[model samples]
Target: MEAVLYVLHGSRVKLACEQAISFIETCMEEIPVAIQEYCFLELADPTIEEAYARCVERGAATIIVIPVLLLTAVHAKEDIPNELARVSKQFPNVEMRYSRPIGVHGNMVEILMERLSETGKLIDKDSMVLLIGRGSSDPDVKRDLTTIAGFLKERAGIGRVDTCYLTAAKPGLEEALEIVKQSKYKKIYVVPYLLFTGILMNTIQKTIRKSLADQDKEFILCQYLGYHPLINSVLRQRVIEAGGGQDLVSRHA
Candidate 1:
């Protein structure tokens, strides 16, 4: 039997974890696989090992592991893989395949545009966008986000879009905000390129509140990228590709 194992990044916040679970549950509904299980990489119930065991107990001879990550980072590239390697050794008879993260998709840019529009503010060429990432030492994180920001700028018909990180990368949120404060753009839209609400979202809100309180600029914090339909579509595509289905053409290309 074939099984699909979804590995989430997990969260310290209960609501964040719950949101992830709910989102994955919805995504799983579209998958036709008989044995589908979800587990957290950390800070939540049903660890990867436990979930893998469940798939085996359910008579899954082949397990497809999908990392529910936004970008190609350490967690997706190393942490989860390392954990999988450890667990796979225990199930030598089972064949395991890994899938890619939802990296650099046109739908993601659409999500950003949707998020900006949700702010109910006019996005003019004079307006600037500051996209915030989760931060990673992996250079791919910066490269991919820069590409997404470029896409956002072009597609949204905006003059400029800048990228920053929450941790472990250059141009932290405070520094990015400071630079934007001195720029010519007065109307700034801050979009968190995050999946769910958690400490990072709260931190962004708090920082924006404290830093831009006295500034005369218009700062609109757009919503984080949640379980949007577009994301679900991307995950469906990922699942399809992982299951030895025909490869789909890149929409962003």
Candidate 2:
């Protein structure tokens, strides 16, 4: 039988890792894969090696590793694949295939739109959107985020959409807040392009509340993208594609 291994970028926060595992469990309910398991990339238990072993012990001849990441960062591009390569050598008989990371999918845009609506702030032409990313050293990840911001602007009919980073990249959260403060836009909606709630999300919320408490501008902080139905669909599609056959093997190797 075929097995699906969902790999998430692990977090130091316990709840963050738990939430990711829980989301994968819920996804198993809808996915047709016979054997389903999950593991963290780092900072958590059941590393990729352990998860791969468990899948084999369960009699899974073929294992499909699907990354549950928002963008094509180092975790998706290098780390996960490198780990998988190491593990694959140990279990040569077991067929392993890796799927692409979820990057700027159409459904992801819908999730952002859904999050924006949750803020209860009207998105008019004058309203500006500050899309906050986790930030990456990878230029590809930054480029992908910029494209997503453009799509958000066009689809939501907002006056402007600016991309910012929580850390590591340019236009940090504070700098982005300053830009919003200077803009003529009456309302600024901040949307986190993240998968689950963690320390980062908490910090972002706290910072937003503190910075804009006395400001004249209205800043609406939206919720992070957590286990939404559209997100589930994207994950399910990744698994299906990974399980197609050996064609996916070369992509990761």
Candidate 3:
């Protein structure tokens, strides 16, 4: 039997974990597979080993592992793969395939734009967008985010879009905010490029609130990207490709 295993980057927040579970469960229902399971990469229940064992116990001969991540970072490149490799040794008889994260895509840009639009504020040439990422030591994280910022600039017809990180990269959130504060643009939109709500989301809200107190500029903090329908479509495409649906993958490629 064939199986699909969705790997999510777990969170310490209970609501964050619950949101992940809820989103994945909804996605599972749409996939035409009997043995579909989800596990966390860290900070949550059902480790990768536990989920892989369940698939094997349920008579799964082949398992396709999909990393539910926003961008290609160290967790997607190293940690998850390392864990999967360890479990694959035990399941020597079973064939396992790994899929890519939800990397740079047009759909992601649409999600960002929709998030900004939901603020009910006009996104005009005077509006500046501060695109924030979860930060990674990997250079690809910065590169990919910069690309997305450019896409957003064109998509929204904005004059400028800036990219920043929460940690491990420059300019940090504080530095980016200070720069934006000094800029002429008064209408600033801060968008968190994250999948779900957690400590990071809370921190962003708090930080923005603090910034608002001191600055005269309008700092509009948008919502995090959480289980949007476009994301469901993206994950479905990834699952299909990982499960040997090469024709569909090639179409996107």
Candidate 4:
């Protein structure tokens, strides 16, 4: 039998971690495979090795490891693979295949649109957008986010889409605020390109609320993407590709 080993980047916040596990459960139901288990990379229980062992114990001859990450960061590109490699050395009889992260998928655009709609704000030519991400040291991560911002700018018909980072990268949120301060747009939407709510989301929200309290500019913060149906669809597609003998190549835009 074949199984799917879903890996999520665990968070210290309980709600955030629970959200990832919930997403994994939903993915398990949507995926074609019957046997599936989930684990976290760090800061949570049931590490990757434990999850892989559970799959093997269920009599799985092949295991497809799917990373539920948004970018090609170190976690997706190095840490998860290293853990899988260590475990694969122990399970000589079972074949292990790895899949790419859900980076720059088109469905994500739909999810962002849904989030924007939920805010009850209309996108107009005078509206500005700030696509904020949990920044990484990796250059590819920034490049992919910039590409996503460009797509949103064109498709959503917003006046401008500025890319910013929460930390560890250029154009931090404060700098982004400085840019927003100079812009004459009536409304600026701060879209967080995150999977679930955590310290970062709270921090961003607090910062925006405090800084723009007395300003005339309307600053709207959209909800983070969490367990959306489109995400489930993307997970299923990645599993299918991995099970079909495709190698784990860089699939980002």
Check candidate 3 and list the clashing pairs.
none
Q: Report lDDT per candidate.
A: 0.91, 0.86, 0.90, 0.86
Candidate 1 per-residue lDDT, tens place, 5-48, comes to 99998888999999999989998787777789999999999999
What shift in Å separates residue 117 of candidate 2 from its native position after superposition?
A: 1.3
Candidate 2 lDDT by residue in tens digits, 1-253: 7888999889998888888888888888877666889999999989999999999999989898989999988989899999999998988899998999988888888888888987776778678989999998988888999999999888888889999998789889998898788899988888988888889998899889888877888888888887777878888778767767444323333
What lDDT tens digits, residue by residue, belong to model 3 across residues 1-253? Answer: 7788999999889998999999999988777778889999999999999999999999899898999999989999999999999999998999998999999999999999899988999987678999999999999999889999999999889999999999899998888998999999989999999988878888888888877776878999999888888888889899787877854333433
Candidate 4 residue-wise lDDT, 163-249, digit = tens: 899988999998899888888887998889999888999899888987786788899999887778898888888887987833322
lDDT of 4: 0.86
> What is candidate 1's CA lDDT for residue 229?
83
TM-score of 4: 0.94
Clashes of 2: 0
lDDT for residue 224 in candidate 1, whole number 0-100: 98
Error of 4 at 169 (Å): 0.8
* Consecutive 10-residue window with the lowest summed lDDT within model 4: 244-253
Q: Estimate each model's TM-score.
A: 0.95, 0.93, 0.95, 0.94
Which residue pairs show backbone clashes in model 4?
none
> Candidate 4: where are CA atoms >4 Å away?
245-253
Error of 3 at 62 (Å): 1.0
